[model samples]
Target: MPGNPALTEATYYILLSLHKPRHGYGIMQQTEELSGGRVRLAAGTLYGALNTLCDKGWIVLKTVDEDNRRKEYQLTDKGREILINEVKRLKELARNGEMILGEEL
Candidate 1:
């Protein structure tokens, strides 16, 4: 099991993108769209993160296209749990910030 330490922005988005099965390019596009273009994953970075996520059992290979040499990945149950937890953590952070800042800062 991976620890609950904060996920890097890239890793977080990568996991989010895998909620539906997607190929590397699809993941890249979806991630950029999801982040409003704030995050653009390069090929090497995307593949590396995909490998890591697979090693962690957070994402799994959903399908492979032998003709086109493309692969699609989707989130595992554990991956969804992790993502949900991350959302909860983010919400808590936002709530605390709003409470403290109070439109002043």
Candidate 2:
């Protein structure tokens, strides 16, 4: 598993955010809005996730709003594919765990 780091929950949501174009503050606001305020990402965490997502090419830098100088991002095709796969994997893992615990039949 060398060089393959697991994604944090915040990281995943950051990727999810890129499904639409959003800036740093927009991301934080949208994340809370999207999660019903149960999950709020701090500035530092959001920036970190943004950087990681950018570095991995999971998100592309979109238009920048110069009036406010805010940079936005959007999901790449590869990013969408990865996110989809990650969702599927999580579902499978949850199913297996529930079945093991006799919660699923």
Candidate 3:
């Protein structure tokens, strides 16, 4: 099946971070850690991406704490599929680059 072509790096990382339910702050921290501090997401950017992902049906609100004020999100089946597809696409791009460069690093 054809996956979303408009998924950005931030969005991809966000989705990957939601492999488990996590709040906004957790998502940001995990994303940075996952990318080795290369993909730090600001609060505004992260929230916006979360809204978009939720609207796209790739993610859903998993929980909300009344007093803590933290809302957790998790990936839906569609989200997992999309994440897997994106990984495949990224791998293919890397493979093509390696082939063209003709030098394995």
Candidate 4:
């Protein structure tokens, strides 16, 4: 565990998108697809989040293609652990809610 707080929906999706190496546009598209089109990341937002994640050591620049001007990023091992923890936390939240509502979770 990284002792991280709960992840925002955008951060969660962004981290999830980096399960494989992907460039900025690929990340954006994959995030939207993963969220069922509910999370369309603007260019500024995407880049900003990418930089922040990089700073946090959750993701790293995996490759840079100078000719095509592409930079690909991938999750660090720490990032994977964070993602897994987030999944567990989310499941616990849903389970608690379902218990209160007396519904299957």
Among all windows of 10 consecutive residues in model 2, the one with the lowest summed lDDT is 1-10
| 70 Cα displacement, candidate 3 (Å) | 2.2
Identify the leading candidate in terms of TM-score. 1
Please provide, for model 1 over 1-105, each residue's C-alpha lDDT reduced to its tens digit, 9 standing for 90 to 100: 574678888889988998888989999999999999989999999889899999999999865878877779999999999898998888888899999998886
Q: Can you write out model 2's per-residue Cα lDDT over 1-105, one digit (the tens) per residue?
A: 553345677877777777788878877887788889988999987877778778988898866766866678888998898888778777877888888987544
Which candidate should be chosen as best, given lDDT against the real structure?
Answer: 4
Error of 1 at 66 (Å): 2.5
Against the true structure, candidate 2 reaches a TM-score of: 0.79
lDDT of 4 by residue, 35-65 (tens): 8899998899889999999999999996677
List per-prediction Cα lDDT, in the order shown: 0.89, 0.79, 0.89, 0.90
Q: In candidate 3, what are the lDDT values of residues 11-72, reduced to their tens digit?
A: 89999999989999999999999999999999998888899889989999865878877789
lDDT of 1: 0.89
Q: Rank the candidates by TM-score, best first.
A: 1, 4, 3, 2
Each model's Cα RMSD: 2.0, 2.9, 1.9, 2.2
How far residue 15's Cα lies from its native spot in candidate 1, in Å, is 1.0
lDDT of 3: 0.89
> How much does candidate 3 score in TM-score?
0.89
